[model samples]
Target: MVRTCFYDRISEKRIAAEALARQKLQEALDAPPAVIEPEPVAVVSLQPARNELTVAGLHLVMPQGFNFRDIDTTLEKHGHPVTFCAKRRPAPDELTLQRSVELYVENLRKNYPDVTIVRQSDRLLAGSPAIALDYIFTAGQERRHGRATSALINAVDGDERQWFSISTIINPAHAELADWLIEFDAMLDAIAAN
Candidate 1:
């Protein structure tokens, strides 16, 4: 009888312990989840300070983000960026700005598929006659817009050559296209002979 009572007591204690564990588990499940906050990101200015650079015998005031790559002789800015390149190339003395632009557009149409000319007009760059051509074309899956400006620089002492500068703003199909174009035009306006 004593053994039976002892066994009964142990079984009761075991049942109580299991009931206590189940009650604790239920309480835990009924509690609300803890909230987590995300980390903050740093904000950067869209228009940074400007920097003056001399490239291909032209003085240019470009934004801080533009980088000059010597391999291709191009100044490029990444992340919704603008690409500017100026080079002196040998050409016939009779090559006018108009003719150079016509040949450029012809080559562009042949190379790029679905070329759409936006505007082509005569403009003055650094007191010299220049031609500006704006166009849009498909590059891979993305549509790109670019402006090409060309001028024939006649040297007083040396052989005459053509001064060609092309500025292209990539991914201009978004909301920031107008702002990018404005910046590009300002950069072009600031160009002068070195």
Candidate 2:
């Protein structure tokens, strides 16, 4: 808990700097003076519609009171690995679902060379073929594992087909949150075609 009873105006410096940065960002967005790289998570404020969760046309019947957050890759530049990451990438029509899965897994291999996959499976998501992978890795002296779900969301846009992924890792210190894992699996199983 942070105490509000700190120093004088000097204590507000950090807050003021953050606010100024936000203002500058807004100004830049308004002017469109420079091109900004598209963020991985493009959707926002995923309001529940009819007790279902939808993002980028992918729908899921989320359970009551369950919570999930969209991952922000921008934070990775600030030294934060996206706790839950999701991304959509356009793929050629010739790419088979199995081939896409293989490509994604290969990219993960290049990124996390030390990771060891414990479980790998394929399933259907929203009526589209999908794959799930569970892997473990050592971070510092702590051993941690993560689960990821990938599905091909057919031609979400007019251009080409797209594939999406949702991956998350629970901090080893808070490993008791097994319920979160159960909810995630249930949600994945509840996916429906849009």
Candidate 3:
């Protein structure tokens, strides 16, 4: 599955510079002695919303008290190969998802010789974070899963892809936790493996 997300501060720096440059340009264009005041920088913070657990309709449904770090640990403990290494999603027009997928596959092969990589799809679901994560999970699983072992490539944005590999490497006694985790592991494996 392919998905896209944006950083809250993506445009902050660029916008500030642009505003200052515009102010200077206007000062030069205007009659002498025109006062040019810089505009205050706008600050945008990305506080995970209360509903952040569910993005774009995909419910992360992490266990109670679960968080990204906790999930990361769980996957690692289960022998699911994953890495939370990507920085941020890129703009659509910046680069194609195919390019990102290719890079991901190449890098994963170079860095992790023991694993396999597969591009799940070129398609992407453009929506909120929840939706994107959900698509990432489903698409990764559908295209890659084979005999309980598979690596998936899903687009996180036009320029970035999430990688992971899924397996029955886990053995948990708690049915509720295990069932939920197998699904989550698939998602993580898809992103982490790459």
The true-versus-predicted C-alpha distance at residue 8 of model 2, in Å, is 99
Per-residue lDDT tens digits for candidate 2, residues 1-194, read 66665575566988899999999989988885676896443221122222454566898776877533344332221233326676556567787777876786788788777888888888655556678888887777766668888776655334545666777775445535545657667866664544
For candidate 2, give the lDDT.
Answer: 0.64
Give the per-residue lDDT digits (tens) of candidate 3, residues 72-116. Answer: 222343444322222233234444444444554465456444444
Against the reference, the lDDT scores of all candidates come to: 0.65, 0.64, 0.36
* Candidate 2 residue 166 C-alpha distance from true site, Å: 1.3
Residue 150 alpha-carbon offset, candidate 3, angstroms: 16
Q: Using alpha carbons, what is the TM-score of model 3?
A: 0.27
After superposition, candidate 2 runs with Cα above 4 Å error: 1-70, 73-82, 156-159, 191-194
**What does candidate 1's lDDT look like per residue over 50-80, in tens digits?**
3355567999786667633222333444445
TM-score of each: 0.56, 0.53, 0.27
Candidate with maximal lDDT: 1
Query: Considering lDDT, where higher is better, how would the candidates rank from best to worst?
Result: 1, 2, 3
Candidate No. with top TM-score: 1
